[model samples]
Target: MTRILQLTDLHVFSTPGATLKGIPTRECLEDVVGYIQANEHPFDHVVITGDHTHDEQRASYEAVRSILTPWHECLWQVPGNHDDRLLLRQVFPCRSEDGPGGTVNFVFPAGHWLCIGLDTHWPGEVAGVVEDQQLNWLQEILQQASQEDVALFMHHPPVSVGSVWMDAIGLNNRERLEEIIRADPRIRLVCCGHVHHEFQFRLHQADIVATPSTGIQFSPAGTSPQFADESPGYRVIELNEHAFTTRVHRLPVIKYHPAPDA
Candidate 1:
């Protein structure tokens, strides 16, 4: 079985003072990294689904690179709404000179599985778009993929998760994307993030799962205030041939006094 980890919406910031839970967002991400390092699991590959930085700040993006480089020994990433493409390119080790926009999507073989990472970021917007190029590439990849061994990772979940605000920011071209996946029997699972709460669904006959943020979380059932008191977390996905499993772990932290709604 090939295990892949997904960490998302980190929102690493430079001057994270009183705005972010009285703690630096970087610290929260460090906690997640520590948990992954301490909790022994030889993940075949790591996927940081997006929002690696907050406010699109250069320093915040650099902080993300600092936190993620050690893990880059086995990792691939896609961008998010809060990301700046130019800065992210500078941060990631695999600096691509592919095209003018620097698309970071590709297919890779990992032992017993075939995985594809798709870049879903749309500049200055919360919603995502796959565009024609990504879709064409995806179809070609899946067409050539071994049956029952393909998986996909993206920054935005394709299905709506009942969060009105979040739904408004999901994949904008989901129908077209769904058409591609639905036609391909080789696809085993679809993994994503951006919505800061854990969400799951069956779309295009594939399992779609989104991990909560490593830095913070949005109340699973809410509409305002941005984040909730939920623990920071990440997903460990076990991939075996045709089967895939995800286990979510919450980080350990001491909050100030009583947690709201505790």
Candidate 2:
């Protein structure tokens, strides 16, 4: 079996002890990483969906790299709205296939699965975009990997998760992306970040799921953005030749809580 760990929304700041919405992001990330190292088995692939740094600075990226050193060799990443693509590439050069300044997308094969990471980052915008270029690229990849089951990783969800604020800032061109997914039966799972909460939405043959952040947790209920008083978490995905399984694992305790009106 091939095991993959999906970690997202690190939001580490350049300043070591900085916090976002009252949560010390770097500390939370360190705790999450430590917990994984202490409790889980080695993962075949460590996929980070995005939002690596809230400040998007070189120092912040480097700090994130240091915390995630254990899985660096098996790491795969894509950019999020809060990320600086160039800085991220500079820190983790091998994580993306793109050049100095290109969309950070990637693809690899694992057992009977074809794992693909899509770049949904839209610079200077909170919302994400799935351009025709990416769609065409995905089409070509799917054609080539026709025989294998597909698992997609991206920063933004292509479907709404019922949060008015989050849905408004979701993938802008989801219709076209959905069209492509509907045409491909091989696409079995689509794991996403950006929502900063756990959610599952079925899109035809694919299970489009959103995972919790490794730092801060978001509430899915409010019309506006709201923080959840919950522990940071990660997703574990186990894949074999014919089947796959996944679950969300969170820290046993909520080390820090968000301010009620932050």
Candidate 3:
């Protein structure tokens, strides 16, 4: 079996102790890393879905790199709405070489599964877009991997989780993406971030999952955006020959609370 750890929505700032809606993001990430070190075994791959830095500055990315040094060799990433693609590629030079432009995507093999990270980031927009070109690319990749079960990782979920505010800013062309997933039997799992909460949805035969942020938590109960006073968390996925199991692990306590107006 291959074990993978997923961390997302870091929202760290260049200035070290900066806070996002009252939660110190960098410190929260540090605490999450410490907890993982103390309680969990080493992961084969650490996939960060997106939102590595809030400020999109070089220093912030460097700070994130420092915090995740232990998994540097096995790290895989994709950009989110809060990220700068060019800056992220520069900080982590081992990513795909799609020149200096276009979307940032990745594909790798893990056990009996082929893991693909889709770049859903649309520059200058809170909502995401998965263009025909990117979807075509995905199809081509899937065609080549005829025998391997597939797992998709992206920042924005392709399906809505019933939150009015979040669904408004979700993947704009979800129906197009959904069609692809429905037609592909190899796709068994889809992991995502950006909602800042834990959610599970079924898309045909695939399981679409949304993980919580490493910093602040969002509540999906309101029409408008609402913050949840919950501890930071990460997801653990274990894949074997033809099946997989996953679970979310949170920090022992809630260290910070979101401001009412934040």
Candidate 4:
């Protein structure tokens, strides 16, 4: 079996002590990283969907690079609504360079699966869109994939996740995206970030999934925007012949403690 790890919505900041929703984003990421570092099972690749930085600052991305560089050999990423795509490209040059007009779209190999990362990031907007250029590119790759199982990773869910607020900010061109997915039998899974909550469902022949954020999680069942009282989390996926399995792992909430008048 081929193992892959999915980490999303890190929201790292340049300031080491910076917090989001009352929790230090950096520390939360560190906790998740620490757990992965201690795991016995090795991963073939690490796919981070998006929102790597909350402030979208150079320093914030730098901090992200520092934390992830150790596993750089297997790291693959794409931009989220919160990310600066140009800066992202500069910092993480490992993405597919042959995409249409510098769009962050590419197909790579992960075990027996053909992994695809799509850039749904719409500049200066919280919502996402898979542009026409990206759709053309994806179609080209799908044609080449043949019968190989393809795993798609992006920052926005292509389908609604039962939350009205999240659905509003979801992929704007989902109909087009879904059309492509329906046309391609090789596309087996669609995984994303941005929801800050774990979600999974089936879309025709594909399994759609979302991982919880490593920064702050949002309430899963809310019709409006609200933060969830939960800890940071990530996902582990095992790809086997003709099938796949996954599980979401969350770090236990760490209560803050003050140093006594030191």
Q: Model 1, 1-262: lDDT tens per residue?
A: 7778888888888664423554456778877787788875677788888888877888787777777766777777778888877777777748322422466665678766788888888877889988877787777777676655778888888788888778877788878888887887677688898888788888756888888887667765556535576678899888876677887777766442213433
- Number of clashing pairs per prediction, in order: 0, 0, 0, 0
Candidate 4 local lDDT, 1-262, one digit each (tens)? 8888999999998899787767688888887898788863888888889999999998898889888876788888888998987788788877535467567765677666888999888988999998888898888888877547889999999998888888888888789899999988778999899999999999999999999988777876657778767778899988887788989988765443222121
Give me candidate 1's TM-score against the actual structure.
0.89
Candidates in order, TM-scores: namely 0.89, 0.97, 0.97, 0.93
Residue-pair clash count for candidate 3: 0
Per-residue lDDT over 71-92 for candidate 3, one digit per residue giving the tens place of the 0 to 100 score: 9999999999999988898999
The residue-by-residue lDDT of candidate 2 on 96-211, one tens digit each, is 78822378999989989999999999899999998888888888888888456999999999998899899989998889999999998888999999999999989999999899
Clashing pairs in 2: none
Show model 1 residue runs off by greater than 4 Å: 16-23, 95-101, 253-262
Q: In candidate 4, list every pair of residues with a backbone clash.
A: none
Candidate 1: residue 23 Cα off by (Å): 5.0
lDDT of each: 0.76, 0.91, 0.92, 0.84
Q: Stretches of candidate 4 above 4 Å error?
A: 96-98, 254-262
lDDT of 1: 0.76
Ten contiguous residues minimizing lDDT sum, candidate 3: 95-104
